[model samples]
Target: MAKTNAEKQKLYRENLLKNKSKYDQMRKISRIRDNKRKKVERINNKQSSSYKSHQSFGKTVKRVLQSLPKDIHKCVSVVHHIAQEFNIIPKTTSHHQREQHSLSIELKQLVMNFYSQDDISYHLREAHQLFLIEHDHTDAYLSLGSFSDLRPS
Candidate 1:
């Protein structure tokens, strides 16, 4: 009876070890599956973000093109090209300066063709203020203490 009890104890210990190993393997597989799911979700999120950005950009271009005069409609391609160049060029570079100069000349000429000098000046001032605000540089402009004098009423 003593020997039989000892054998039964040993069999129980072996069964416990086998069950523990299976549980560990299942846990490892679950962790791997969870990691794979998270990775896929991250990739999908990035793709959706990229798609939305591109869609918004296309809408902006379309709006700009539609706002132009019929005679100047052909210049839409040029405007798009300029926009692409501006995105790539840093504000502090000479190439960026040249692009800015060209853009300003083109805008002035376009405005002058359909509007008075006063109107042109008003629009240009408004555009400059909007740019400062959009770029979060209004505080810097105000700190110079000369913005009030330059700003239009």
Candidate 2:
């Protein structure tokens, strides 16, 4: 016997509801899988050793300085001394001869280009402290120590 039009319409509605529920379930499963994958990726990143081993600018500068030849080290020391004296004494041009001044300027540029600005500044401050100690400028050395305390770590 052939089915009536009303009965055929009812069956079609039931099948459509079933397909809609299946689609909803598939979508929910896909969302859960995506969330799990993201969590795993985050955990892996946290566990990687390379992610934790970062070097600071100052440490890098120290390492590079340690490997340099003694001549270059002495040159840097001379430049540092001249620079410190230049800052402290306004009329110290006579102390630094033309050749010495040019050498100091060249060394300053080389240091600035080789390392970061912060690293060069830190080294310069250290050199200033040494210079003050060598010249028996106790008062200036003490003041510099206090000033350095205000700088960020």
Candidate 3:
């Protein structure tokens, strides 16, 4: 026969106490693991932040300038002037330079072909910002004197 109701209650309480000790032990282990995980995260966060902040100095600027297209020297110079004027350091010329460099020669010629005279002016306005220069079609009239305007005709 099964135990009476009051006896069953006592037995259940004893069993619960026995399991409670194991539960407490497991809880302690879980808390220690959680604390160790938090400590590692805090350390990682501190190290990453320190490294990031340390990388924002002059070497970073030089590295950025080095990676830009050689053709955009003029544009970079202009950007540098603007940065100097505003006391702001420009950090992202690579995207614009990369976009221009990746355009196919056919695409560039197509763009030029499609432009109207008015559009040429608009295009040049933006293009000059990226160091492209515009010149007239007329040949330069110059003296043939020795060493005069050494550029080939």
Candidate 4:
């Protein structure tokens, strides 16, 4: 014969009392683990979101800078294309002046042929920072940095 309601209630009370002391500890550990999991998820979400924005922001800046008017002097592949073009190549900077190096005549003509004085100067000033950042050779860096000093000779 199966036990009736009274016996079932009596058994349930005994089991609850027997494990009561450990119940709170188990609950606390479960809660802590859940909290850690939630924290990690939050951090991952934040990192992914910020990383996406940073990559897109960099591309946007490059596109805007490269597509500006009167950028017709040199072939602009990207934001730092001008810097890499002159800096990485060894023979680009032909010689040194008193304090600064000079770009090859061909290179000078390439840009000088297309732009007016004011526009060319404006482009150089704006692109100067990129050259400084991307240039490898000291001569190319010097030549590009001091381009405005070059006369029409």
Candidate that scores best on lDDT = 4
User: Who is ahead in TM-score, 2 or 3?
Assistant: 3
The C-alpha RMSD in Å for every predicted model, in order, reads 21.3, 25.2, 18.2, 21.5
* Model 1 ranges with Cα > 4 A deviation: 1-28, 37-45, 48-65, 68-73, 87-153
Models sorted by lDDT, best on top: 4, 2, 1, 3
Candidate 4 clashing pairs, residues 3+ apart or interchain: none
| Clashing residue pairs found in predicted model 1 | none
Candidate 1 residues 13-40, lDDT tens each? 6776689887677678989999999999
Better of 1 and 2 by TM-score: 1
The worst-scoring run of ten residues by lDDT in candidate 1 lies at: 137-146
TM-score of each: 0.24, 0.21, 0.24, 0.23
Q: Per-residue lDDT tens digits of candidate 4, residues 8-110?
A: 9889767766797776676788899999999999888665344357778888878877676555554443424655666763333434547644567754554
Number of clashing pairs per prediction, in order = 0, 0, 0, 0
Clashing pairs in 3: none
Score each candidate by Cα lDDT.
0.55, 0.57, 0.54, 0.59
Error of 2 at 69 (Å): 12
Q: Candidate 2 or 4, higher TM-score?
A: 4
